[model samples]
Structure formats: C-alpha cells, structure tokens
Target chain A: MTGHEERFDSVAAYALGALPPAEAAAIKEHLQTCALCREEYAYLRPAVTAVAYSAEACTDAGSGAVAVSPLLKSRIMKRVRSEAASREAARRIWPAYALAAACVAIAIVTGLTDLSLNRQNDAQRQTIADLAAPDARRHFFAGGEVVTHGGRIYIAMRNLPALPAGRVFQAWTLARGATRVAPSSTFAPGSGGVAVVALPEAATNIAAVAVSVEPYGGSSQPTTKPIAVVRI
Target chain B: MERVRLRDADAFEALYDGYHRLVYGVAMRVLADPGAAEDVTQAVFLKVWSSPALFQGGSFGAWIARVARNRAVDLARSRSSHGESQLDETLVVEEDLEDTALANIDGERVRKALARLPVEQREPIELGFFGGATQDQIARQTGLPLGTVKTRIRTGLRRLRNALEDALTV
Candidate 1:
C-alpha cells in the first residue's frame, strides 16, 4: 500500500483509541485536509463508540449481577435537587430587580426627578474620584473600565444586561507567570445596569483581569466565557 | 435534553434513570472499584446537568457512555502510572452517526454484536476501549505482534459495525 493508504489503514485504531500519540496526531492532521480519510473516520466512529455499550454487561466474578448501590441514586438526586433549589431561589430574586426597575421607571415618569438625579450624581462623583487617583492606571474593556491605584482595583461597568436567575458577574485575575485565572470578587449591577466594584487584591503582580457570568456563590473556575478581559 | 437545559429536575432524573446503568457499568469495568466508579458516575451526570449544551447533538447514550469511560480512565490513570491511552477528543463525532441505526442502540444489542466478533478482534478492542490499554500494551499482554493486533481491532470493529446495522434494521 502507498504511504497515504498505509496511514489511512490506522483510522479504526485511531477511532478505538488504540493508536499511540504520535500516530494519532498524524491521523488527526491528515483528517483535517483529507476528506476521504475524514469520511472513513466518521464512518468508523460510531462503531467504536458502540464499544462502550458492551461494557454494560460487565459483571463481578462472584456477585450475581453488578449493580450500583440503591443509595447512590438518592445521593445523585439530592445534589441535583439542591442545585435546582438554588437555581429556583435565584429565579425568585430576579423578579425583585424587575420590580425595582419598574418602580424607578414609574417614579421618573411621575416626575420624581430629584431622587433619580441624586443617585446619578453620587455615581458620577465616585467615577470621578476613581479615575482622578494620582497613581491610577486606567484600562478600557468592552463595557467597562478597570482602574488600579493604591494596591486596589476598581471596576466600573455600564449597560450590563440583567443576568438570569442564579447568575452573577464574577471577576478573575491572572497573576504574572501563572497559567490560570484566580477568583477575585462577584457583583450584580444595580437597577440602572451600572456597577462599581472594588477588589482589595494588590494589582502589581496581576497580569490580567476578566469578568464572566457564573452561578450564585460563584465558581472556583470560570464556568462561562469571559465577557471582558483587560491586560494590566 | 431541552427540558434538562431548562433545569427540569424530573427530566434529568428520567435521563439518569435510563442510562445510569450503562454509565456506572462502564466506569466499574474500567476502575473495578465501586467507590471510584460511583464517583465517576456522579461527576459524569453532574457535568451533563451543569453543561447540557456541551452535548451539541448526537446520540445521548453514546455521548454519555464515552464520557463515563473517559472519566473512569482519567481517574484510573491518576491513581497509577500504567500509561493508559485516552480517547482522542478530535475523533469524537458530535454530529450524527453515519449509521443512524446505531443512534439509540443499547447495551444488549452491543453485547450481542460484540459476542459475535472473533475473540482475536474482540480482545484487542475490549482492552483498548474499555481497559484503556494501548495497542502495544495489548500486544504485550496477548503476545501478538503490534501489526497483527491493529489488524484484528480494525477487522473486529468493522464486523461489529455491520452486525449492529443488520440487527438494527431487522
């Protein structure tokens, strides 16, 4: 057989994961540009995948039938239910934001102007003070600014859409020479879709800052893609 | 899947009930430890619950089985230095299988199909796929040449594939 044909012969082994790494990498690269090999790989894939099913018949040498513990199902369901309840609680709180937003809109429509303007003024002042720090370094992101000064970080964001229930925006930092992002803080925007969150971690050693939407209580790792990332 | 995506616990429970055996079975086969198998099974299902969208499209059974096996293999590798092989993620087909007949295939059908494969072909496949052994390792254990082991696996799988297609159509 030709060299290409010889390589193609290994597709089944590749599908079954029997090929070693170097040979598998070669087949993967070849599949990228070679439609014929891709077709063969696709054809063989399901059959190999079906091999996993044969495992269902796995049995113990002494036991009559190998079965999972009855309690295991309850254990799994308990965690599932707890997560669902957390999600449900998050759903319930979300409507409170909507009601608060509606009340603000009604107040504005009814000419309750001073209260709204005062809140805006306070926000503006905070933004000014944050940006005017003598040592502050400002970096702009998609919808926000991250300002670092006096060993602290200030994140000012605007026009962020309200998150679904059980979800919050979480901030992450990557330390210099570190490969993974570290969890920093979590926050939800106000009814006006604006937030100014302060993080106490020193910014000098930080390489980058990112924000992603995660479930309530946040995750150790970013569960969703980052909405914003700014290099320091 | 759509209901589970909406966080419907009942729907997810139904999914778990239907396939938990296959998942636990795969893990048990690889890990041979009830505790480790249970851990892998829990992790696999939780992953489905948290990231239902990870399964873009395809047979849920096949997708989950692969997930169970891979997770068990990872755990096994972590506990030992045996140099187990891993499923190449790139070769995992997210799209529909070429033979849709295999889409909803269950353990019984597959068990029968595999039983029909020659022992030579079946041995290498079982060792490589479920046991996470490399072709070389399988060759060492079975005292067969590497090329012979490779050929048997290829021929065995092709036969199993045809057998599945024929059985499903019937």
Candidate 2:
C-alpha cells in the first residue's frame, strides 16, 4: 500500500458517521479525487453496515423490537405514489428547451426577432464582461487551466481522453467551509482532446473547481478523483 | 429495484414493507428517540422513491441502512444531542451485524473477532458507533487523550478488517 493508502481506516470511521464534521468533510473531498480509497470504501461499506446493524439487536414486537408506526408506512407510500405519478407526467411532456426553441423560430419568421436577438446579445456581453473582471483568478492542474470571474467558472482543457458514448466530464466545486462537493455542469471534449465548459454559478464561496468522468447527464458526486482541480 | 425503476406502486410498497424495520431500527439506534426515528425512516423511503436510480445496482439493504444512519446522525447533531451520553448495553452487543443485515455477512466470525478486541480499542469504537460520538467527544467522554482515542479506533477498525478477511478465507 502507498503511504496515502494507510489512512483509509478512516473510511470505516466515515462509513460509521463517527468523524467530526470538518474531518468528515475533508475526507469526502479527498475521496472524490482518490479511486483507491473509493474502491476500499466500497469493499468495506457492507462489513461496516453489518457492524452498525449488529450493534443493535432489534427483535419483533414480542421480542422487544420496537414496532414502527403503521401510519408511517401509509404516509411513505402515499408520498412515493404521488412522486412517481408526477415523474411519469413529466416524462411524457415536452422538455422546456424544445418548446422554447420552437417559439424562437416562429418569432424570427414573423419579423419580431429583433428583441430576442438583442436579449441574446446582452447575455453574450455579460459573459464577456464576467470573464474580463479584474478579480478573476486563474490556475491549472493535471488536465488544463481554470478561471473564475464574476461568480462564473470557465475550464479550458486539452489532453482529457475522449469520453465513451453516453458519458461526459462533470464539473464540481467545493465551496469554502462546505462539506459536500456540489456538481456544476457537464460536457464532453471536442476533437483532438479539447473541452471547454463554463459554470456561471460555480464561483460563489468556492475554494476549488474540478472535472471528473461521469455517466451522461452527470453525477451528484464524483466517483473518482478529478482529472483536474483548479484551486481558488 | 427493477420494479422500482418501472415506478410500480406495488413494488414500492413491497420494498417498504421489507426494509422499514431495518431503516427505522438504524435510525432509532442512533437517534434514541422513536418520533425522530420515525420521521427519518419516512424521509428515507421518500428519498428512495424519488431517486430509485441512485442505487446503482448495489446491495439495497446496505444503501438504505447507510442513509438511515447518516440521516439519524444529522438529526442528532441538529438537536445538539450527540455529546450527551446515551450508551445502552442492551442495544450494543458482542454480536455481528451480519447476523441480521440483508448482506448475509458472517456474524459468528465477526462476533468472535469483536470479542477478541482489546478493551482499549473496543471502547472507543463502541462510543463512536453506538454513542455517535466523534474522536474528540470520545476522548472527552472517556477521559482519554485525543491522540489515544484516534489510535484505538483506527487500530480497532484495522483489526476488524483483518478478522473479516480471515472469516472470508474460512
């Protein structure tokens, strides 16, 4: 095992919810960038879970195991069904983007496109202004360079491997004093291993921004250490 | 999970029926309060329903148990009650969780290994896991130095991992 591998017994501590808040948060950030630790964690989770449950010998009602309230089950089931129905409804409808695109096409054809074009130009100018802000910070890591400006993050990278079909590189940010690494956006590299993704909202209170390989549509958490991290 | 993926109400209900106790038990074990545990349990199932895709084909029981424990700990911290000593001997036993956990891990072997643990190592582990105490809290509660508490817990986990490996070989 490598020197860093030796500290992973804390993964057990992490799984058990025994670590102090800041320490736990630090471990989580490290776990995002360490595949070896993630693998060890995956292997140890079931065992630790067994230990956690065995810590309490819950029996049936006659055996002194506390019974869950019957009302809880009904309440849970009711919420689940309601959510499932809503999801089904959502799936059957057209996504907002498609509808918005169609409306824009109609407006342009009707000669009412000036206002829409002006709004798009304003957004483009704002993006340019954000990138040009004097307080912008720039840094580089394994894959490429990152810049944060005016509450927005931009990653320009070359040398990232071409993602397989249905996979993308996800951007993540660890805000100052935050325990969880929040996901920002997703993109795939273009021709010749070049990719650029901008996260307009990733600059708030963030200490660093990173990119990780993830399944298409992105993951809420990184499964492995990032290909690159731009420390703020 | 397949049925859950399909959004089948019957399958969801069946899942709830099977795992409610384990979920509720883990929450109660940590929170030490039935009302809070019940709320956590309900919230957990609701999360499962909303994001069935999060399972990623792992052991369903372990996933739910992990969520239950984390949520319970969060609730305990929010209530500022984690520091209050709440250890109960009846709840914490020498038995292994494998005995009843859905993962079917080897309980007897784990029990034997836990029984063999040095008291110095075992005490901190128990205080941390069963009592929901951090290393600093364990140190304060046991009057052991912080470094000593950290050493004992890490050593205990290392030993437990070794014992588990031995059991797998057997």
Candidate 3:
C-alpha cells in the first residue's frame, strides 16, 4: 500500500515485527535493493531485539522469588556432555583414510602440495566411487550433505568460510543410541570454499554425521560448534 | 562463547547460569506458563550449545533474549493461531549492537526505559512484541484505528531506541 520511499516509515514497525505478513514481505523485498532502508533497519534492529530484555522473571507471592529449576541446567549439561563424549569417541576412531582425507582438505585449504598427493587421490577416487555406488544414500545439513554407500561415507560442503590460522575442519559421526560421536576426518576447504572428505568406515550403525572447525592435528573432541550435522 | 564452542561443558554451564533467568523470564512473559517457560529455557540453552555458530556476534544477552522470545512466540502461535510467527530469518540483526549502550543493557534498565514511554505508545509495542499480536489484532484489542496502532508502534519503537541509546550515555 506504500511506495518504495514511503516504506521507510515502516522500518521501526518492521524491526519490531509489527507488520502484517504481506506488508512485512513487501518491506523485506524492498530492503534488498534499498541501501537507505537497509541502513535504517540495521540501526533500529538492535533496539528492537533489546526490548525482550525488559521481561522480569515471574515472582511467587509467597517466596517473592522465581528461579528456573536447578534440574534444567543439569539436563542441559547432560546433553552437552553426551554430545562432547560422542564427538570425542569419533575423534578417537579416526581411521587411516580419514587422516588422508583430512590431509587432502588441508592441502586444498593451504594451497600446499602434499608428497602423498597420489595416495590422497586414490582416496578421493574411492570417495567418487562410493558416491556413485547404487546404495549411496545422501543426508543433508545446513551448508552441505553426506552420502553413504557400502559402509563408506562421502561428505561434500560448499561455501565454507576460511578457517583461522592453525584450524582445520573435522568430521564426527554418531551411531544409533550411542553415547559418543566418532571423529571421522578433518579437512579444510579450498579457496572456493569447497571441501570433500571421504570416510572408509562401515556406515551400518552410524546415525548422524557432523563437521566442525578444530585446531590443527584435530582434537580428541570437537573444539568448535559443528558447521553442519546431517542425520541419516 | 569461545570456550563453549570448544565443547567445554563447564563454560557452557557458566553461560547457562548467567542467562537462564533472562531467557526464562522472556519466555515466561510471553507464555505465562512455568512448565512451558522451563521447556523454552532448556531449548534455548541447548540451541546455544548445539549451534553456537548461529549466534554470530553481538550482545549475547540481547541475542539470547530474541532467541527466547522467538521460540516462545512460535510455541504460542502453534498453540493458538492468533498471528503468524515472526520469521527467524527476518529477525536476524545484521548490525551488531555490541558497541552501543545496548551492549551491556540489563533487565532493569530496559524495563525503566520501556516504562518511560507514553502508555499509548508502549501498549501497542508490548502487544505486538510480547503478546505476539498483529497490528489488526492490536487495533481490535485496544479499540484503536489500524493506522493509529501502526503509527503508535513505530513511534514507540523509535522512542524506545532513543531512550535505550540515551540510558547509558546519561
């Protein structure tokens, strides 16, 4: 109902999420090409987000204080520990090809030629063969996907941001009802933000696969939040 | 956040200890159900642990508050179809407010800033933001014209932004 310029008036409302769906969508579309509107949005957006901080915890009439249950923290930490332990196990189980795949990723990421490039190429070809396997099943996550076939897992991610110095991308896997995620491999993306890792482990019991940025040589556990976690 | 991202359970527990109240309070305000609020609190912290990268950078407080509110509002919408849930994608704050007065803002400061708003301006924002009411619903509930509701919300947010910016400066 408003012109492109007049849409400026809705920035605050838009930031507060007060607009109707159609109107909000219109403003969202308009902001894409309008630097002025986008700037205003960027400015006021924080204030809008900050408003939620005004909320107070509900107080009990008798106790005069309301706090979250202690069990909640325990529950959360329990899950976090479980995930960490799983990833640690995955790291411990890092197979030979997993290391080679990690080497390939590092080679691509750092632009360094590896003496074992030929051996890594064989691993890469194995990944391709696994990808083309009739039994290959693909699982998708946020930035990329995993394909599993005949006990081998092939992971391909695109547009991954460059890792910091002394950091590498590591993969982890979780088996069904298992307490830990097994470290599958570690690799870095090429300049184009592309990474391809191949795991030669049997995929029969694996339930999920994830990728994270870890320190060089990889860690016994994930040292960063996973960039992607694909459930098979 | 750095430690937590490193899969440090202790660091994450410290984060939860510091922010659980804020996250739960925001959810409680929206849902008004202790059980539901607890569930949302748990979900929020779990999300922080599971996907710390989702939080790019900013006032961790404000970011988590928004995450709490969005999750609570989503639950509220699913329980009863009063209004569409605000898309999380749209709610992504592009500019980090880390350098502003809002960076260290707390509940009391924000509450006082909100209280300073004129009742007419404050009511519509509260309705839309916390109550998850659309402008049309706000108009119906408050018996005001739709345009008036929109104007008041816009005006209120601008004033709130200015007030927050001024809170720390003065």
Candidate 4:
C-alpha cells in the first residue's frame, strides 16, 4: 500500500480495460510481483464485471435493432465440419502427397483461389451499426443505421419502399455550421426492402442525415425534398 | 471442457447456447454494431473450440465474457483508426444507468454514490469505461491534462470501491 499508489491507477484502468496494449502488458508483468496491486485489481473486478454484464441487454438500434442471425450458427458449424474433414483427409494423404507435393504445389495453390472472396468482402468492412434518433420521422415505416469502419460508411435500411424504376435514394450529410450539405452515397434497396450503401468517406461532425429520391444513378443536387431525415 | 477439447459437437453447441447472447451483448455495447457483434460472437466461440485448453479449469462464463470484451475492444480500436481520442457528447449514448451494471443493485443508491463524486472524477470514468475512450484520448477530448485524467480515474475508482460496497450492504 505504501508505494503501490503509482501503479494502483493502472490496476483500475486494467479492470475497466481502458489501458493501451503496451501499458496493459507492462502492468500484467508488475502484478506478478506486487501483491498490493493484485489485491486492488481483485477488489475492482466484480464491480467492473457487473458493469460490463449490465451492458449485455442494451439495444440502442431501436426499431432497426439487429441480432446475431440464426443462420450464422449453421454457417459456422458447417465450416467447422469442413475443416475437420480437411484435416482428416490431409492426415491420411500426407505420406503419399508428401512425395509429389513439390511438383503439384503450384496447382494446389491455384485450387484454393476464390474459396473465400465473398467472405473477404464482409470481413473487410468489419464494423456495422444501426443509427437512428428517437424523434426521427419514419417514411413508410422504414428505419436504418449507419455502419462505419476506418474511412468507409455503410448504411443499412429496413422497410424502405422501392423507388420509381429509374430513381435511387441519395444520402446527404449536414455538417455542423456548414451551409452546403455533402452528398454521401446513392443506392436502391435490395430484396425484402433491405438496402446497404457503402460510402468512401468517413462522416464527421454530422448534424443531420437525410435521403431523397433522385433520377437514375443520382443528381449532384437533390431533385426533390428529402424523404426522411434524422438529426444526429 | 474435456469434451469440447476433444471436438465434441454437443459440448460445443451447449456452450454456445448458454453464452452466445451474453457474448453478443457485451460486443454490441462496445462496438455498437449488430453485424460486428455477431462476427465477434462467432469468433469468440470459434476461439473456444480451437483452444479449449484455455478453459480446462476456470469459470466458463467469465472466460467467454473476458474474451468477448477483449475482442470487442480490439474491433472498436480498429473502427476508430485515430484511436479513441475524439469522443464528443454526441458519441455518448445516455442509456438509463438502471439498465446497466447497477441493474441488480439498488439503482438509486449507486446513482447517488456516482452523483456524489466530483465531476472531474465521474466524467473520465464514464467516458473511459462506458464510452470506450482511452486515457490519452479522454485527456485530448476533454481538454484535461494527461496527468489529471490519470489521477481522476484512480481517485474515482477508489471512491467507487467504497460506494459500491456501501450500497450493496444497505
């Protein structure tokens, strides 16, 4: 307790998981020798655990709330089974393939091509979220959320009606204190009235976001009033 | 655990059924994305399946929770490529505290305890723990000195330690 005050703060941070990796690693090493810090960490663990556990039930997505798709389990289980089969096959064929492996190695490499191209697309986007405000007016009972990772933005909408065959929904961003709005992206909803639009730039200091119907492809300037708007 | 280590599908399924929701929830809170939460949840389970030795003799729930949280944080860090140094008030989701970790405890008591802490102490803790901001990021976002942020977090945690104990006792 006498000299442990210096590292005590980090123990608390470690419990909350707010420390960066290097600092967290350094603290973990120190905890092995510092009984005082370990005691402090133990005391904080429960309260922190409780806090994290409480977050389990939070759903801020409102009507657009998304859950882990039931189909995902089947997909994972299928992959697991396939991997197991592959391992077994490799084990049985190892000694035989070991002889000609070097000669056919290039062919085996070519065989694996495009095995995961679709999955790679999903994997690259990473972060996905539903964005909505409580007072947002729903058009045709449609709601949506904005998902972002790095500098990319993906907007996913639900219950949105199909536009005129030649029209598309254009997204606009109203930055705080800016008079002119920036056009974000344009796309038509996909099947089941669900649509996802990926934008090239990160949305920053956005005060309001809206969508409007525009002619085929889209217009540099909105051709009509916004169909829906959410004040960020 | 042994069954899972042996690649028993039934054992793995049971573990997933019991813990997937909690794992998904923790991830949702941190990453605020359902797709990402689902991905993290699947990854956490796969991690358990691939490395069952990590859970041979410990609380399974705690292990999964810790793993879920660590994965979620890692994803959040990647989401914020500039690091978590730019939290604004708009970024804070003001969910009812009762709906949080204090759900099982006396909400009013815990609220009162948190309310009693100085703003300086409470703000940092809230931003760091709940908002997922790092200490350096918190200092930059709040315009507070770096040393001050560290001191406040330490002082705040100490106060919370006392407050939580007292609230639970009462």
Candidate number with greatest DockQ: 1
**Which model is ahead, 1 or 4, in terms of lDDT?**
1
Candidate 3 ranges beyond 4 A from true positions = A56-66, A95-232, B81-101, B166-170
The TM-score measured for candidate 3 stands at 0.63
Per-residue error (Å), model 3, residue A68 = 1.9
lDDT by residue (B61-97, candidate 4, tens digit) is 5456666777776677766886542222211111111
- TM-scores for all candidates: the values are 0.65, 0.53, 0.63, 0.48
Q: Ten-residue segment with the worst summed lDDT in candidate 2 chain A?
A: A93-102
| Tens-digit lDDT track of model 1 for A65-127 | 567776778999999999887566634533344333433332322233456677655544543
Score candidate 2 by TM-score against the native: 0.53
Interface RMSDs of the predictions, in order, are: 6.3, 8.0, 5.0, 9.8
Could you give the DockQ of candidate 1?
0.48
Model 3 residue B154 CA deviation in Å: 1.9
Q: Between candidates 1 and 4, name the one with more favorable TM-score.
A: 1
Q: Regarding TM-score, does 1 or 2 come out ahead?
A: 1
Which pairs clash (backbone N, Cα, C closer than 3 Å) in model 4?
Answer: A131-A145
Q: Residues A93-151, candidate 3, lDDT per residue (tens digit)?
A: 33323433454564454334554778656655665566544334556566666877667
Candidate 2: tens digits of C-alpha lDDT, residues B129-154 = 66778877888999988767767776
Q: Which 10-residue span in candidate 2 chain B carries the lowest summed lDDT? A: B87-96
- Candidate 4 residue-wise lDDT, A104-128, digit = tens: 2212212323557664334332322
Error of 2 at B51 (Å): 2.7
